[model samples]
Target: MLSMHYIQKGLLFKKPPPPNNQKDFIDNLLENLKQSISLALFHFYPLSGRLVTRKTQDPPTYSVFVDCSNDNPGARFIYATLDATIYDILSPVDHPPVVESLFDLDRAINHDGHTMPLLSIQVTELVDGVFLGCSMNHCIGDGTSFWNFFNVWSEIFQAREKGRDAVVSHQPFHNRWFLEGCGPLINLPFKHHDEFTSRFEAPKLRERFFHFSAESIAKLKAKANEEANTNEISSFQSISAFLWRSVTRARGLAHDQKVSCKLAINNRPRIKPPLPKEYFGNSVDVVSTETTVGELLENDLGWAAWKVHTLVVNHDDTEVREMYEKWLESPIVYQLGRHFDPFSMVMSSSPRFNMYGNEFGMGKAVAVLSGYANKFNGNVTAYEGYEGGGSMVLAVSLLPDVMGALELDEDFMNVISVANFANMP
Candidate 1:
């Protein structure tokens, strides 16, 4: 009953040369990293555990749980070196290399069976910096949990370097029973097993990085609110609406074609008695808005933004709980792999993840990219840019043709900050 998807995140850190008094800086850093990871695992033991299924009923019904016993195999840690520099990746290139090439994917964690480690970290030493890639089983947690582990791990590393004991602000809660008790435990057999078998096929996709400056976001918000005739539209809604329209237009779908925009909404805040901020589990649900291509493109930007806003606003506590109950009735979730025709697009991650703040004593990350994002065409991941101000970096993946069209889109290019890409060395 393990989830078919593995959540993977990557962080790029600038490597500083060791002092004249110290030798082999990279080796010393790696040793300290290993120790820090060991200490961090003490607080996140489930990561070192295995996902095993236990019989829940007489007829072979089963439930999956993390086995963190002493004998359980520990999390996998891999180390490697790359000939290229970090700048080669951070620079704005017309056609960025596939993200997989930037990290050590050979040691990536996969959802194979009960014996597979729940977490795996691969550290690659690049010519100018380091790249850390973490893969966690999605069945155990979501992006929140993933970044929580990373931040804590970084805190431990920084504290260790300064000879101080790290103080954790929040501890993760691992009780899966709380969720099970709220609704029926329905197990839907995997119908698309073939999708899992071929998940790693080299995708015919091109990834691009788009920067939206604070001023541009402000303009988008203002335009959306003014067009919708309501000031209630959020920046996320506004930006998502703009992206939806831009991508739909880039794809050049039929006027009457049905198109959908899906967002991964975190339900923690919307739940009754809201789950603890440190609740380390999957608390996200997908909320989608569907409309005809003609309506979506012809309508005012506010109309699309309002549609996104309302779709999110309507999922109140009651609605979320109801959705949970329904999920329990048929607990099988399917993965929407690559979309070749581009009828829909999914926007995930958030600027709020604060990935740029993950400093491992080397300094803040120059860039952060999700190793597992954009597996499907038309996938968009938004993150706070390294520039600090309220700028945003969108990691977008689309078909080559659609991306070409988007690159030439005047309206879309007008709002994006060319300065960021222009200044790339």
Candidate 2:
């Protein structure tokens, strides 16, 4: 029964919508959700599902599925014995949820008092209690894509319930078509590089939080850029370089370790006849910045940023493209590979992901996952302006103790303190 519960976190529009027939309202919401998923190559995985539990005095966030086979299908929904009350959560909110503007919703989600596990709903309404929640395969895509799928489904359902034609059509990307267009993955320069491995399970994993102000990062970048005489490097790149160098440094301090940084590269282009912006699905690849810690931190920020940028931008390198094409041509890429230990860490900067328009009635999400965690360990996701202004958040897997040790490093501290914002205490 636990396996049937697919978990996803989203906000409920506390502020009610216009009164309408209950059946029409739900159908409309479902229609919009379906249309969103149809926009991409997302139907392959059954990741979308819905439920409606009887309202309780306490707010709901987790759904428990009951029986699997019977006339009633699953047992009737019951409230979680222990949970937070709606009044307890809403007493601090500055304002009620909003509709129309996505930005307004974004602000609500990011507010200080708002807590994690912000909202949860039962999963038995759409399916029998026996079959609850939707199971989405991670390889199908990322969180942004998932959210888009849900939103469109809601829109389409709403229209249909209103006795209107369903205008949204699903036009997801075809994996085979994408592969044929990109050609085969052949002998690439980095073909020998190993795939990423996981480090620990949930219980064994650790979280380290880092806060930095924007002014400090700007100053550091100004100095580095002037000294290095590089024009294109930006502040975000400079900070990332520092973190990359820091991770490598940590690995070295552990004794001349061979560390590699996986940098995510968006593949909208660099291929002949660039892919259209609207073409969604997973069109991303990770290029490794493999280097011994001894070589990575030997120089200043400029050198580090340049190396990282070079690795990222050169996606079309004959060898690199060859390796990818060859991998896809193999049937294995289509099948899930064996789970292995993740040796390296994934690094991503989301300066704008949270800022995108997500308003849909309820106010914005207080926090969004940085997209770093997986079944593996050593995932790192950083956001410079998560809620705008200058506040920053770093989601990492390092233990708090090691993070404290990093605070003592002069170079690491300076990079975090100056390159972007002041380091959080």
Candidate 3:
């Protein structure tokens, strides 16, 4: 588990009409959701538990084990109603709504071990829709675990509405010791971890949502493959490459300034034998590719894309296993925090998360937002757009000046669709 971090996700769904004999739609929805969450918690019991730190070791460690006893403090769940419509968030604007404003402030996950809740849910009913805000302690799980819980909760709600038993296709595997055999026992210094986390404190940056239509993505892929002189490029590689170049240009760095792009790669599939679909925890490695700002921007887009692709391709199962072994031996895992050098961009989240498929018996999610962008600058969280058809939404946070420059880049804006507030403010 990645301690000291919170994965906050907001999902918006269209409000369904009141069922037969139900007077209030929002009240019925809230009741149903609360009941579903309670049912889901029976399976994901750890989320209802608190963190227990073991300080007896040379380096302290923490574990979030299930505690269903009477004294156990359960996960926090809040229900509220918002006066605004979903358009107040999804409509095109100079800046997207602060991700924090979408949820209840008191219910957010606290990083402090003493008061942190493993999971917090706030369902806010909007004028025309409903917003489901989830704040989960990263120490208990990652985005994968968070979404898995959400899907399961939604399934339970849908099943109850249909008067049927929900079938849980995959049950969560909570054995953190499963990876012990992959590497040597290494002590993690709590102080060092705290210091590393402190470096990611909220920066003075603006977050904007950029939509890339299917056609734009196609153009990017085509250009990247054509430039790389190979058809081996993937959509992730292509978009990453394009963003890397554009962001570098936006920073307007000197020719001698070096720039790097760090991508969060899911290590679950890369591991030998592969982790089970239900294996939930922090299983991500930040892999990076570097180049001079001049070279990155001056070269063809495909060139940068190729570099990104190679970085991912080189991290095969063997390399991943070796990394695990090395991580096990190291006293501290220093994640790529805010870089002090020549500029760097870190991208997290993936279009493969199926952000739009979370249907809670109401329709699919019309919009998805992440609150993490408020804490980390140069952070770009990607999601599968509701429009589908290979569309993507990039929730980007960067320094104001750099974002200004990025919006002005003609080459970068060529394929962007202005219909969805993607144009400059």
- Best of the candidates, lDDT: 1
lDDT of 2 by residue, 1-425 (tens): 10111113233222233474545644444444434334322332322221211223344222211111222222112121213223322232111121111111122111111121111222222110111122232333443444445444445545554667546454344342244465322222222112222122333434444555676667657766765687776666666676777755554354356666675565656656665433434456657776666666677778877776677666774545686666655522211123222436566435534432343323442333321123234556655443456446565665434555566778766644321222111
- Candidate 3's displacement at residue 9, Å, is 0.7
Q: Please provide, for model 1 over 1-425, each residue's C-alpha lDDT reduced to its tens digit, 9 standing for 90 to 100.
A: 14235777788877776452223777787788899999989998888888665554446464555778999878888887778776676664543554565544333334453666778788888877788888787777787888889888988898888899998776777655345355234344443434233343436888778889888898999999999999999988999999999999999989999999998888888887788878888888878889999999999899999999999999888888788677667765444443323578788888778687777767777677766533578778877767857778887888889999998999999988542532222
Give the residue spans of candidate 3 off by over 4 A.
1-4, 17-23, 57-70, 95-98, 104-110, 177-186, 190-200, 333-342, 372-375, 418-425
Candidate 1: residue 60 Cα off by (Å)? 3.6
Prediction 1 global C-alpha lDDT:
0.75
Report the C-alpha lDDT of model 3 over 190-264, residue by residue, as the tens digit.
543364344245557777777889888998999899999999999878998888888888887799887889898
The lDDT values for all models are: 0.75, 0.42, 0.72
Model 2 weakest 10-residue run by lDDT: 124-133
Please give the distance, in angstroms, between residue 37's alpha carbon in candidate 1 and its true position after superposition.
1.2
In candidate 3, how many Å is residue 348 off?
0.9
